[model samples]
Target: MSSVPLSFEQLGSYSPMDFLTPHYRQQLHASLQYLQRPAGTLLLHKGERSLAQYYLLSGKVAVDAGPARQTFEGGSPQAHMPLNGSQPNPATVKALTDVSLFAVEHQLLERLLGWSQEAAYQVSSLGGMVEEQADEDWLARLLGTPLFGRLAPSHLHALLARFDYVEVEAGQRVVSYGEPGEHFYVIKRGRASISLPSAYSEQPALTLGEGEFFGEEALISGAVRSASVTMLEAGELARLHREDFVELVRPTLIPQISRNELARLSQQGSRKYLLLDVRLALEYRLGHQPESLNLPVANLRTHADSLDRDTSYVVTPEGGIRSELAVHLLNQLGFDAYLLGEQPPLAA
Candidate 1:
């Protein structure tokens, strides 16, 4: 904490967030809050659930650990980490002066920190088949995804049972634009190229190597194929029919959140919920929610890969099934997604 000089203009300068890489810290920004509190406040209490990680950015605080009491001024090593990080705080902390602090949900901070550390060092093969990896690695990748991560092990096993296999040759078309999207394909071996067709030529836009997946756009959006995938090398793919995919995968992936609930979340700190408006650029420019990010639907699939997984996104269009479709697609890629919609309240 002493590394940064206290400055009102640079909140991050005094934050634990300063230690994290830019990419990792951006993911936590939505769930974190900055606060200024008056003196004489009990910043923390003994035996209270540790709901958040509190860092004393600029403050004087006293900690009572049983019979002993110690004072920690701002920038001291004793105040570097959250006080009483255990489930129930072991001691009480009281503010001795007006203080500035940063707080983030304890569980969220831990999860993102773990993921960031893991992802930072992870190395994977671009050519190894999905099923060829060690069981732990292969399964973890499946469970790490947004759509399948929450599924029970038993459900995942059952879902895998429904897939059938096929081998494709180099230059073979897996799916074509303007055709009905009837199946989702998970690559088992080799690589493929994804192209979007316009006029007389198909422009190659992405490459899908082994262990990656494709063909989700049609199923999630219920639209004709938006692009085509052709094998770049002889490959094997596991295919799941649209009906089976809908029955097994869609229900658990998409969420319908009410306006009031979204409002309540927004007021919590204005950092947790991002109301994403995925309409055309022109439509979004006309009118949209305050603070919403404008990403048109056509580009959503491409840009979704870059979004921070730690933040919760409420994807919306001019309210209808369109919003649901957008959220559903986001969920497939492991995004924390929810849709803004209306449904009658249940009787209490």
Candidate 2:
């Protein structure tokens, strides 16, 4: 191991890191400390319990397990696998060269991986929850979205009772153009391609993966479906009937930020708020909110994860369907977002 320092971005080199959501990864990166250790160091001792996972980014490690000693080289294809992943390591490992290692505590990593959220998703009775083993944060993630953020907890819990799970196979068509939207679908797992055949699109214009949702435009606009959704991978899905969506939802999407409240939040020392202008390039180029970032609704899903979870975004211009859609999409996708409108600054 080299004695040089490492950066948090290097965490991407670690395997299984993709199991974490972008927001969760950001949290882990913030908590991780850079480390480098040298040869002859005991990376793991045989039969010792592991409280954390170890990753090697450089150098070689010799493992003493069974009757033989095997060597693992850093920078190899599988170098990112957790070293001694078993709770009680069955092998003793020694550094063979100057090594770069990062240890992530199991507790924090598992918690951030959404395991802790599972218990919260359980139902007291057998009839309510579709799967007790479902993603624990599934409903919480929806409620955390801007639409339901202000909803009474009881109401959101009730809404959770209405969800149903559906398994989809790769190449399945989840929805089609010109169809009356009957349900709103949220991707529970797997990937899907979204494209509009009527629009003369030659390829999928958009794609959604886990925690992403679709079929809302028709539900919200009372219009026929504009696009077709096809599964890119076999996965589970959760759907809410349109009537349930309208009656239990729609109303919760009223969290709005007045111009002054936003400005005040932007000035607060602890709060980080951004004024987002979701207008066309030409319109935004003409004039926009001071210090606002321009991320059009058409491009929001692609760029949404790039946003830091610690910040709140106020999306403008207020009341435009485009802005409202952008706000809902951002909030629904786990961002702290609100429709932007202006009121005079409050009296100081």
Candidate 3:
């Protein structure tokens, strides 16, 4: 028998094992097997029954499914057949270098899934190898996104773990206005449309493709969706539940405003409050806070005189650096200001 002992910490880097209770890790460890593959090997093919899920202990592999392509390079692990569903499109898995892998068969996994928490831990620890590889794939893609740029590494990993991949067909309504929001979605492939109701025709606010995200506001605020989002074509998406939204997305969004600060600000009447909407005139005309004064961020400096020095200005921009910068500009101008909100809003 091989005498190599697995390292749990190393595996945690690429898997959701870190999020699992300690008991589950022990369960996984008992049923896991370590594997080593030489270079130039085919791990699995598309449409093949997944007998076992494999995790890279050390090495690399490339996965291609039709137009969607992802490569799991060395130093990070990769997982095969982690999800239960129809077989994935036949994907050619090629080792870029000599690879070390840990595997757990579906039968053993089935037994582990039904086991007690302690047993689950043992199984999970063993399963950690596969989980880590899957995690690495997700992490690689997530870290490459601009939306996740502001996040710290730890926070980013947590968010990645919470997301589940989903696929939708063209013309499917992913989200509907007035429906309770459940998950926030990020487009991984294909395109989607953001639309809102209108008398003549539904206004398409935007068309987004790879790396775009939506439903954040709904997730944060727990409010009815404000717009309808439909898949423009068959596509893949990464979805984060509301619970994950609070844990992952919310912390990275606009910095937290203190309750004391909010209370103090609320005591001041509306006349003392200046709501600045910094979106385009057309967007402002489409919809906005009725009381807000439209002074698009671009024109704010030129029209500085439009703002009142006695009032506390509240800057709002489409969720991004624009609004944050607006606040900075107001501060530099000796005006008291805070960021209020943005358009095409994200969840609170």
Which candidate's TM-score is highest?
1
CA RMSD of each candidate after superposition: 8.5, 13.7, 21.9
Candidate-wise lDDT, in order = 0.67, 0.69, 0.59
What's the distance in Å from true for residue 70, model 3?
Answer: 50
lDDT of 1 at 332: 69
Q: Candidate 1: misplaced stretches above 4 Å? A: 1-138, 147-154, 199-204, 270-274, 277-296, 299-312, 317-319, 328-336, 343-348
TM-score of 3: 0.38
lDDT of 3 by residue, 130-218 (tens): 35454334333443343343355445545666667887899999999889988889776779998876742643368977766788766
Ranked candidates, highest TM-score first: 1, 2, 3
Best by lDDT: 2
Error of 1 at 331 (Å): 5.5
Error of 1 at 239 (Å): 2.0
How far residue 162's Cα lies from its native spot in candidate 1, in Å, is: 2.7
- Model 3 weakest 10-residue run by lDDT: 120-129
The collision pairs in model 2 are 1-97, 1-98, 1-99
The candidates, ranked best first by lDDT, are 2, 1, 3
